[model samples]
Target: MAEPTAPPAAPSLQELQHWTGVLGRAQQMMMEAGIDMMAQLPAAKAAPAFPAMFDPAQAMRAGAAFWTDTLELWQRFLDPAHAVRAEESPEHARDRRFRAPQWREDPVFDFLRQSYFLIADHMVKGVDSLEGVEPRQKEQIRFATQGFIDAMSPTNFPATNPEVIEKIVETRGENLLKGLQNMLADIAKGQMTQSDTSAFELGRNLAMTPGKVVRRTPLYELIHYAPATKQVFETPLVIFPPWINRFYILDLTAEKSFIRWAVEQGLSVFVVSWRSADASMKDVVWDDYVERGQIDAIDTVRELLGVEGVHAIGYCVAGTTLAATLALLTARGEADKLKTATFFTTQVDFAEAGELSLFVGDEQLKMIDSLSSDGYLDGRYMATTFNLLRGRDLIWNYVTNNYLLGADYAPFDLLHWNADVTNLPAKWHQSYLTDLYRDNKLVMPGAMQIAGTPIDLSTVKTPSYIQAGREDHIAPAHSVWKITDHFTGPLRFVLAGSGHIAGVVNPPSANKYQYWTNEAKVSSLAEFVAGATETKGSWWPDWLQWIEAADATRVAARGARIPGKGKLQALADAPGEYVKTR
Candidate 1:
């Protein structure tokens, strides 16, 4: 069978135009150099058309060496005594392409695997050594090259992959028919593959935490989780989860739940479950997210808990909104509404926003706005965009399993939560892309406004705790650290182990990841990392302790507080209507 071809990644028209101009100039420079070279060497037959960085002679020599290596590889394979051993590399850690016992003994498969890695390394090095290319162009070339490399991975093709071959033999070709059926089903659904949809149920298996929706608005639902402890903190804890996915990420399972954990710690836990957007919410803007989303949720929580101030925690996009809201409230001299603020992998400064930044800029932003002008931005588009960033895991892995190997996707809570995407309001998403990613207005004092008040981050002096994942590509740790400079009050920064979501979802029981915390404020991120202390396990307990210490003065044990007792009554059961909209 033919190997699966890599998804095309042709350069955009803009990139092509820019590079065409560069190449035209380069050709002009080469022609000029050729004339000069011919003038210097009267006896020469022809002039060279090469740039200073690229020497034809050197390229020829490199090509000769590559073939020499290829010849030696073949020679070793033909030798009777030749045997191959498993080679491990950081890039190919989880790759099980050539792991079968036969690969070690089979000369053909061994040589192919070896040659593949060698060629990939050479290509990467050549790209890295291109001195004359623009930084952005270099990044694009590398990204495209990496995609090709992933596509060429032996496991992606059933014939070359030993595991798939073994499976075919064991099942007597039954797996191929099953794989075909899976591919057909995926095509029918307009999905790349089956994402193991049966793995999770919204209210039954997942998002099962006991809670009641005390307040509901067009924008979001405020969920007050039933407390596990008798006495709760006088200061209520309201969590604002990212609207891109469901709020259940915070309450995924009983063991991994940060929400349930807080409840057990004697804190009145209130979570904001954002409504999945549709055509009706096409007019919802960033202002609506601020007023009707965060502010409304906060007000409802305060009213129910009867607290003057609430401890607020925001994750990802929600964190960005919360920070902006706090800035707006501060401008209006109402900063005292929040007791302590915690931000999880939130990027206020978009300067170093990582790979996602590639999809921004004027042209892309205009395209996005134009496409979603009439209605909400489809969740599938956003999901595909995110998946493209980590295609090896999110895209091609499923292609290999569901299409090539005929394997059922494993049940994973994280994957299920990730697949449950939420739509973005047209105006809201456009404003976000324009103000935050495009213009980077959040870091600029008085640059953003909400509710007729200019948002100045410097005026927001609420005590803060910021946590960022070291490997978080979406919101890089460096970008999160920049928030410290904009904040007027004391700030603590923690660098957690793992990627964007896993780092935040880490529970103490997992005991898998480690975190770094620096007590002393540092001028630069490097300085902070240098002085940071590494602690094994989740950063949740440390954050909880920080909030508890800040809110030391507590009231008598009040037992589990009932939702809607104070003001807004319970509208429905926990995980509310908005969460189950999809």
Candidate 2:
């Protein structure tokens, strides 16, 4: 012992007794949050699966592995020479809550973030690894577990989040008071605010493209967008947007407006403005929308243009109805009336429908029916269902911004439209859920009926252009691909770069996300993707080209400025009375 042994080195700050204790407390809070959310999973669906949901032996093994991993991490963490760092990979770095400088630069927070992920990631893998559970039921469990984990992120809690702590310190606890007030305001609004709601109006900064409402119906109003070119395609184009949402989404602003861009392309463009559902619409059925709301709009466009054939485009749910209408028309031997059909992020087959399917089972449908006080689902209910699909971006992110950080939402036109939810008529919704979602009837020959006409998708042979968003969750690209199977005619499938709205509403001026195409003969979406070529601009031009090819005859462009040409008359300005109401 000639050289006195140096005193044992003290633990690194990351592994100090006090820091470990702090982490233990933080872990407790996260676990409590997870427990609270787990308690909310629907008992009706989950109770049956509970026995098969998790193997207790496997779960214990997972728990033990998690602890083992944690111990190993602590060993590396305690080494004085080793520094803790958050994963730098794109996938791991996406948790925006940890983007703050301190989260990575400070070892304490770095350890906390890593620890939470270690636990949550194990839980996710464990749920995924569970065997013997029915495939569909297994999917529900996985989804619920992920949502619960996301809700319990360390960034969501005030004390666990250093950014929020700094805000409190900077504002001398006034941030808490402001946050409380903000929470109260959000509660009053009945939904979280994702944009500056007061910053945009229906016709001013948003949905500002010039147009006029023509031929109003009880269910919808047809709009003739003011013409942008002198000569236009002879075939008029009518857009049947999803009635579950307002029509202005396609008409938002001059730049992002798909409606405006179509007019500018020297095409006769008309849109259907659907009336928001009320108690009066309780008895409205699927056939009513197909007839009065969609088919009627198509008839109005043809009549106004004095054309035997019209081009029709449908978005989301409207596209499903369009498909049924195509079949119904075919049953009546009037299939040629619609010369061309275009579908935007629409699904006819529910076999591979995304997270929305979780809400379509009998128990949930019963709940929805019960909530329909006078026979209509509230707008907020649908909004909440969609919001839950992307809880991190849609729910907790806003929670941190509006509640913890006390910040006002940035003004965004798209989000403003998103906040404007649409109510759904009960009968229309019921038939939709039962026929399409529950029974998968639309694609089956003679299985679906619209009005008195039996619908058979294969009987409809109109040329079709199907555009599906690569990132769409509601209508997954795969689910949308099923349309190609049933169209039974010349069909072009295009995959765009972004999610549903961004992918569809994309304009070339912005020069943003890319689209994919495949000219090679391919039966399945997988083959299409394998042979697909990438294009670095909006799909709008691609669609215009398809429209031109579908019908090349040119006619004088007609706009709302003209009083009436055939059987249509201008009723009011665009972004009409229906859209302005809730």
Candidate 3:
């Protein structure tokens, strides 16, 4: 009647219930079929004639044991009074209110969060593709999957959903408890705060290493080491460690120290330890470092111990300085005093300096200019720059372990030494960056000048030994090897294992570390690169062999005296006061 309208559009309770029941039945049927198929899959995959040695009994027992322990832990954690207090805690309240909404409101982040689950769902289907993977590899893959799932579980998500909130609270509480326990354990084991003490001790030890004060025209300390017995060579050995850090990196510790090793090997070792710059040293330029730092030390060594010539070992930036010094001396016909020179982990060419190039661009130069306007390149600035190069390991690792994990810092002497920062004269640093890094001028003939003479490496007739590390990111191998081509001397280039610091600190005990040497003559790096083979052991032994051949036979021992003068006044001991002056 009511216009013969369609039956009142309404779902009766009975109809609704019937449809729900049918849906329930269909879901049950699908679940049962899925379970059955899953159960038969392993049987189908079982090797041809033999059944799997399925240890269901053992698995059941293990599951029972795990559940039993879990129940006990759950009971302890769910104490009513404690649970109520934890729920009302500040952290919990913060998480429940502000943090959850803030996290969800991030647009790009929400997209990523939703996309993760979709990708994970697809990955579950992709597991079938791994059927032929090795059993161990399959287990590894499963473990990795579980690990990722655990990391991304609701417990780690900040959300308003009841399940996610509860899980987050529970997991964070557990983590807090574990962290406190670890802190206490470390304190009891005497591992906590060891880093600070170790660093302090390293500074103390470096300050105590005896250094000699050799007074020349330019006042600087010359750390000298002469073997107890007759010297192996008539040529004195002088070591010029880079001024970027302290000179003592080559003499870090007695057992593994390079300077100690060279001294014990019967070579006269003289190291140039530059003083930390003061207001007076503000105008010191690159030429000043060579003239006052290297050349003055050379004159002191020559005058103090009258030697026919000296063998020089220059490392990193010091090597560059030494090469320039050699060129200058050659131009003036004064290079006859140097018989041989060795460069360690040093770069003459800047075409491919790797990560170091990134920080030397215009912006950084401007920043340096602003800061160094006071005449000194602040040591802190330099330290921060180097630290940024490997921030994950250098900076963030310590932050996470110290602040988050509440773990004690592990002290390493080398790291302590590295952190002993030193400032560079602003003029020297700015000129270095602009000339060497920006222009790559030092390696180019007639591009660099020292003491008013155009310096060129081809005129460097001193027999040369060049060493670089394969894993050195600061100075790429290609950039370092370019020095060989620029020189006409009998050059031997060795490639060592490890990075910049480790490469220099390498000792014979590190036998597993390998190096490459070209026994046959090779003109360029390309030629040597083609024929090089990896050989085990430290490159020091090889360097020593080359040095011994260049050194002259030892003559009668002369007392410690400045040559061309009356007998020299003796200093306290071998390691004099100069190096110990910080």
Candidate number of the best TM-score: 2
Question: What does candidate 3's lDDT look like per residue over 295-389, in tens digits?
Answer: 87787778767775788888999998899999888888999778899998888888877667656656568889898877777676787677656
List runs of model 3 lying over 4 Å from the truth: 1-211, 216-219, 230-232, 523-526, 556-558, 561-582
Ranking by TM-score: 2, 1, 3
Instruction: Give each prediction's root-mean-square deviation over alpha carbons.
Output: 10.3, 4.9, 19.8
The TM-score measured for candidate 3 stands at 0.66
Tell me the deviation in Å of residue 483 in model 2: 0.7
Cα shift from native, residue 241, model 3 (Å): 0.7
Candidate 2 C-alpha error for residue 332, in Å:
0.3
Q: Locate the minimum summed-lDDT window of 10 residues in model 3.
A: 80-89
lDDT of the structure predicted as candidate 3 = 0.63
Superposition TM-score, candidate 2 onto the true structure: 0.94
lDDT of candidate 3 at residue 269, scale 0 to 100: 68
Worst 10 residues of 1 by lDDT: 41-50
lDDT of 1 by residue, 1-582 (tens): 999866434446575456445433533343344334323431121223224225577556655765565556544544424634345576654455555655554544555566566666655665566555555445655665666667667668887777788889998988888999988986786556435788788777788878889878888888888777667788988899989888899888788888888888888888888998999998888888888888777876676667788899989998999899899888777788899999999988898777787677566677787778658987877888888888888887887787777888788888888878888988888888878987899888778778777788877789999999999978989999888888889788889999899999899988979999887858988998899899999999999889888986665544336665556677999989999896
Q: Relative to the true structure, how large is the alpha-carbon lDDT of every model?
A: 0.77, 0.83, 0.63
- Report the lDDT of model 3 for residue 317: 92
Error of 3 at 52 (Å): 58
Superposed on all Cα atoms, model 1 deviates from the true structure by an RMSD in Å of: 10.3
Backbone clash tally (model 1): 1
